[model samples]
Target: MFKNIKNDLPASIVVFFVALPLCLGIALASGAPLFSGVIAGIVGGVVVGGLSGSKLGVSGPAAGLAAIVLTAIATLGSYENFLVAVVLGGIIQIIFGFLKAGVIGYYFPSSVIKGMLTGIGIIIILKQIPNFFGYDEESAWDLEFFEIDGGNTFSELIKMFSNINPGAALIGFLSLAIILFWDIVLSKKAKIFKVIQGPFIAVVAGIIFFTLTLGNETLSIASKHMVSVPIPEDLSSFVGQFSFPNFSVIFQHEVWIVAFTIALVASLETLLSVEACDKLDPDKNVTPTNRELLAQGTGNIISGLIGGLPITQVIVRSSANVQSGGKTKLSTILHGLLLLISVILIPTLLNKIPLAVLASILLVVGYKLAKPALFKQMYKLGWKQFVPFIVTVVGIVFTDLLSGIGLGLLVGIVVILLKSYQNSHFLHIEDNSNGKHKIKMTLAEEVTFFNKGAILKELDNLPSDSYLQIDLIKTRYLDNDIIEILEDFLYKAKERNIDIKLISKRGTVENPESFINFFKEKPKSNISLS
Candidate 1:
């Protein structure tokens, strides 16, 4: 891991800047103390990164869990009680890892996964708009359709337009310009440009801009748009802020349910991030999902025990890590350490950094994830890909992270089922020497009830007076409902004067109504012969 320290250091700096606001935002979303998000970030980067199987994946408080965490906190009655659930959730994740349930990541369609990434990218961009204009009435962490302050993302935008902080707007525009210039212009100039990463440069510039703005009391920018870190008088006082979990809630059924919910959602998000990170890795190294779960579980357990929010393999931060050219796990670890050191050693300095500057960094990251080219590429892949991708993007924009992805996944599954029903089986036809056309109806090898509609449609469309040869020779399994389907088709065939031949392990039969009868005489097993 130390081998890539030169590259990783620069990358870590970029991830640090990107992670700062997100940590605070997610904490705000979870209804936890803002410091809890930072605590999770520290644990995610230091503990989880140290134990991670993934070389490039970064872990942190995820937006995906924002809704669940919010609901869990509200229902649990106390934040301390919620911490109990978080720790238990971590334990549950550890069990999941041991059970080797990580394979769930492999089952998602690639198209839908891409849609998820793009959808998140759009959300990041949308969420940052208010911050960019210095509208601190809401934090970047707000992901709901309507915020606690009321109105949706669009309403916030309108509000931002009516009341723009000139200082913040100026800093935001300058920060964005500097980032864009470095990313598009200077980065191409030389290897030194690459060595000094764009995000790092953007942040330094933002700090300098903030410092310049500081001396001017007439400046409209309030300190709210700046990075806010909890400033304690001393180390002992800072440590006093940490809260412990109320283990008394451990016996509550609702607490367990919340724990289970967190475990399930956190584990799923980690699995998805693992899949996505593997795709993003330049070397294409696949992360061991079970080990990733273990790493995350350990991180969450540590985080909760120490008064941190739950952690997951966060795609936004990980993608930012990768885009910033992070080459190993060291980058992720170092960034966590940076968060720890900065908050402790120089929180006042951190507070001086403008929120617009952070927004600029995220704006760049978001643009990279949801580039216009991505939209065109998905469109070119056809509606099968485009519809789900757009739906996910819109859903995430309108609703929240998980809901949009769920909508996209639902649409994607329907597409798959529709395709399956449309092409239930592969059919071949030929004419025999007797001048009878032999229609060889071969059921799919693993026919399920889902295929019944298609099979019935095809059978119903068969021409009358045809010689039908039903072949289940290679079929290993068939649902009983399909057998009843065959029985009904047989009655219709008898009326059409069609000749029928059924072939299976039971051997060939010219016409067997006894075998193809109603559900009463149907075979007990799902797979039947003849």
Candidate 2:
């Protein structure tokens, strides 16, 4: 970890810039105290980052949990009581880690996971459009398709055009240009460009632009469009920012319910992010899911104790870290430290940076996540993989993150079932020298009820006066429904004057009186025809 400090340090600064607005924006969106968001960011970075087995995955207050936090806080009656739920939720997540529930992350299809990354990328670009134009109605961190301020995604974009601030638009375009040039042209020219990230340059330019345009009526950006970090007046007031949970609420049934809800949701979101981060990792490093859950549980416990929103491994910050050249957990830890120090020492200076500039940085991140090449790549993989991938992207764009993933997963499952049904048997039909049809049906390795329909259709469609051979040489397990189908087909075979040949390890039977009786007479587990 220490060996990559040169790369990690610079990457951490970029992640720090990305995380700051997000921390504040998510908190504002959740209706939680502004400081609580910063606290979550601090704990997510330092504590979770320290314990995590992942080298590149970063943790923070997630926008995915904003709606849940808002509802829980209001339902719990007070923020202090809500803290109790958050602590308990952490405990539950630790239990989940111990129980090895992390395997759930592996069950998600690759298509859905990739869709999630792309979906989030598209959301980031869409949400940041308003900020980029200096339309400050919504928080820069809000990722939902529908705004909490009572507008939809497209509506906000429409409004931003009419309400664009020339100062912000100019700075945003300039910052974006600098970022593009640094990444595409300057970075390739020398090693120094790699060490000094484009985002940092963009931020500095935003601040300078803000300062120079202070008095110009046509170009000056408003305070509303600038970064806002809560500045403590003095030592006592700083301490006042921290809030303790009400332990008495632990006995309340509702508290436990809320705790379980947060644990389940936070654990799921964290696992999804862990998978996505590993996918984004240039080295393709696999993260230990169970350990990640434990780390997140610990972070949430600490965050809640100090009045913060629940934490999860966030894809936004993690992707930013990877894209900015983060090499290890050191980048994650350093970013947390920056969040802590900046809020304490230079918050006033931090607030001077324009949100439009930050939006420009995120726009690049978004574009990378949802690049056009990825869509074409998925399409080339065939519809089985492509449908889920496309559905996940569309669902996420129209709905929220989790809902989109669920929809995609559901589609993927249906696809799997359809394939299973189609592949359950191999049917080969040949015309015998006597002009009668010779039909041979080979059962799949494992035949379940899903295959019953297809098997029945083939049996029913067999031409009359034909010889049919039912082969079960390689079958390991046969469902009862398929056996019943064959049994019922025996009568039909006799009615059509069709001859039947049943082949199994038990030996061949020609025109068996009953299919079920033959199988019951010699029930061998490893029955296979030679």
Best by lDDT: 2
Task: Report each candidate's C-alpha RMSD, comma-separated, in the order given.
Answer: 2.7, 1.9
Off by over 4 Å in 1: 215-220, 427-438, 503-508, 513-524, 528-530
Q: Could you give candidate 1's per-residue lDDT for residues 1-530 as a string of tens digits?
A: 68888789989999998888889878887788989999999999999999999999999998778878888889999889999999999999999999999999998777767877887787778779889888853547766666766777777777778878777888788888887888789889887887788767767877887777776865546877888889989979899878899999899999999989999989988988888788878889899999999999999899999899889998889999899888999999999999999989999888888888888888888888889998999899988888888888888778876787788889989998887786667667786547666788887777778899999887888777789888888777788777778877777888987888877775777755544542244454585543
In model 2, where is the ten-residue run with the lowest total lDDT? 521-530
Worst 10 residues of 1 by lDDT: 515-524
For all candidates in order, the CA lDDT equals 0.84, 0.90
Per-residue lDDT tens digits for candidate 2, residues 1-530, read 79999899999999999999999999998889989999999999999999999999989999989999899899999999999999999999999999999999999999999999999999999989889999953555777788777888988888887899999999999999999999999999999999999999999999999999998999999898999898899989989999899998799999999999999989999999999999999899999999999999999999999999899999999999999999999999999999999999999999899999999999999999999999999999999999999999999998998999999999999998999889999999876758678989888888888888888888888889898988887887777677778888888888997888887666677856755677665444333333
Q: What TM-score does structure 1 among the candidates reach? A: 0.93
